[model samples]
Target chain A: MRRADRLDRLQSALDAGGYLRLKDAARLLGVSEMTVRRDIASCDGRFAYLGGYIAGGLESAGGMGYILDRERDAHIEMKRTACDSAATLLKPGETVFIDCGTTTTHLASRIPADSQITVVCYAMNIAEIVCKKPGLRVVMLGGLYHASSASFSSPESLEMLRGIGINTAFISAGGVHESLGISCSNFHEVEIKQTAIANAVTKALVVDSSKFDQVKPAFFAKLNSFDFLCCDDGIDPARAERLAAAGVRIMLP
Target chain B: MRRADRLDRLQSALDAGGYLRLKDAARLLGVSEMTVRRDIASCDGRFAYLGGYIAGGLESAGGMGYILDRERDAHIEMKRTACDSAATLLKPGETVFIDCGTTTTHLASRIPADSQITVVCYAMNIAEIVCKKPGLRVVMLGGLYHASSASFSSPESLEMLRGIGINTAFISAGGVHESLGISCSNFHEVEIKQTAIANAVTKALVVDSSKFDQVKPAFFAKLNSFDFLCCDDGIDPARAERLAAAGVRIMLP
Candidate 1:
């Protein structure tokens, strides 16, 4: 198909549905997924490729919070791989705390719809997804809501978190630097993450390969604090070795 | 325009956008809103006019939980009036606990986007709306999620709610019989409602007139327990007098 025709088809699909999956778009356009990706990339902010889906022209993409959705879309495959690896650690009949972030959201998605487990989360997106599964019981940590991240937190909520006994807490961070330690963008999340880490029997830090060697505003914990680091196979060999040497067990999907 | 033509236009618009406002639909069809309503009402479930918006032929209506959405759509105008009255009781900087119900969800929507206040809620639908307002602080009570209602509850969460100081709690119920007392469908919500009513300085029951003199399972509190009953003028004069005589101050919007 001609480039113009493909673009027209993509635009119309977006207009009709507000969003379309890349694979679905590929099938519709009679082209490969890569070609569809290229088509979206070629456009200048006219459309957005969000978490394996192509959303209509910017301003908004239905609900799901556009900012979080956009961030979730970036490096989605790697995040999915990391989450797939992280999900294996979850055993049925166990309580797990899933943190707020694009990475942990992916992990929440990877949880089986029919699995019998209890999920504890602080983010709306995570709760929204997991609450639909009949077999999974969801516990949401409620506090003051921060819109930028679609998360809720407070001093009281943090205290509430300290009381819950979690088997495994899958924490996500904006930065995971060896020397600088781990951090995230929101300060409110700092105490909640720290509390969840402290309470959980096993603490697993779930992040994509892209977060390595980066640091953000709020420092939560040290990289060596986590029992396992779940990520994709995209980590550099030297960096992997350094992390291993630092006593961080890395789990790849 | 012909009925067939109006139906075609409505169907095509729904196909393109999934949902459209009733006013917008009327404008598009170049007819009165009542005509559009009649057209939709005449159809045998071909489309759904939900909360002033016409959703595409059902199965799903793009999240918002189809069940809750359908219930909310029923008697939406009355619910809006009740919520509008309930919102007036909210003063800046006051902490209010909004309960989990379609009526209270309407109340949450009526809250100004730029208002400065603290909102404590246990329902996802309420949190999703109030959290977006930057000036307002939202505290979510997390617990075992009931997907049927999109609300969370637990014994621990009820304990957590007891600790928070709420100026006013706008509660909703499935049934509000004069003699039978108040009740809801889910038994899990019983303790939470009782706790919030017990904690708040002012207990406000916000429900449409349709809920008056009805009874359901899981009784929580008596009708006289509420300081104010917010509803529309659609309420029967005798019923209103009976409630007022029972020491319940009815607030109409």
Candidate 2:
């Protein structure tokens, strides 16, 4: 194979699998381990650690290689649709509360710059987006920095929340079951979500279809806590009906 | 001086000044620099490198020493008094949000453990207190950790916040003025405070009397964004009246 073809094959293997041992890549490329190492080095440190090479700074390849190379199973497009639908419910002048999660981030891009609304958030990404909105105001609650999610939360965030109220709050859940309500993988997140519900006049739950029926370790609040539950069209109708029966206005698009 | 007395003197010097150079300490103790280094080492790394030797790990002291010594500030009592009076507005069972800063941290201790409220925060010190409060639900936001204040902020935190709301937001401003509104020293903090206000129904500005009239780089909100303004009795009456005229209920103690 040509050197370029070998490199392409190596990239394809790494993109398909998030991580690869050196020997595996070598075997797949039908090249010696030394040749594989040399090829990786030619890429200028794009290959990292035991996790293998991740395509970095190659925006021209449609940003596909980087996303595919990551191990996450969630679909970004579904999350974006959910977020867009959630953003439509917020008025220009209202104060909107946002929680942290990859799905909720899609709402940030849709928030209109002309809106006079104030956005209060625990998610740093949303805060950055709201800050750029011309007339929109943004607030970030201070807390412990969780590196994986890149957000802050602690008892201090709750303390600062005393005496403040919100017009609306948007939340995400790791799992949504008729009996389990909204659940998350971390106990700390449950505390934050519960507090968010307690303070809002209206609550909306934004989650993708894939999250349904999946149970996480912690329960933050019951499904009844939310006035609106937004999910993609892929959600099972029976489950949607159950959510609607619980007084949740279900939105599917 | 006796050995104990010498140690006390060293500590006192550090307290009086923010730091004490090792060479300076040696001259004062009538010992060589090496001997001083050995003496400090005897305390088992209690001394920190402050370009030289600084007292370390003395919690009783109130100043910042190389060795993590707590030093007594001349304004300690005044700050404590201000913090005590400000903390009374917070009630139990309410979701509280705390902003990031040294003065706001003082309020953390006053939160009664018996209260059934959940606390969400970005301040690490405040989380420590919430952890001690039995049955108090503590939620921590995850994000990029800021070493200066030991807090976190990032896109992930914004995403996480989409799921929750706060009852009240307790925010501190770099500058609180009748004309300029509430401002912060950094853009990131401004965004965070704005998010807190939007998430809550009520907004409370907690500031020392000295913070009034100071202008910061970024504007978080107008003075009227808050429902209540809590400050020390030392605020100028004219300025307080101006704030009250701007629709902020002034609370002075």
Quick one: best TM-score, which candidate?
A: 1
| TM-scores of chain B, in order | 0.75, 0.71
**Candidate 2 per-residue lDDT over residues B1-253, each given as its tens digit:** 3554455445433321124557878787687887776666666533443346363222211111211112113333334455656677787778877776555655655566678776666644445344444456666664444433435566556545544578877887767766777787667666667777888877888887777778888888988888988777887788777778878888766
Candidate 2 CAPRI category? incorrect
- Among these predicted structures, which one has the highest DockQ? 1
Give candidate 2 misplaced runs (Cα > 4 Å): A1-73, B1-253
| Tens-digit lDDT string for candidate 1 (B1-253) | 5996578556534422235668878887789999999998987566655556675523221133456445643775677778778988988888899998666766775666567778888887677557655578788887667776678876657777888899999999888899989989888888888999999999999988898778888899999999999998899888889889999999997
What lDDT would candidate 1 get against the real structure?
0.75
Compose the digit string of candidate 1's lDDT tens values, residues A1-253.
5886577546533432235667878987788999988888887565655557665533221133456445643775677778878988999888899998766766775666567888888886676557655678878887667766678776666766777899999999999988989999999898889999999999999999999888899999998899999999999989989889988888997
Q: Mind giving the per-residue lDDT tens digits that candidate 2 earns over A144-197?
A: 544334355666566555435788889888788778667876666667778778
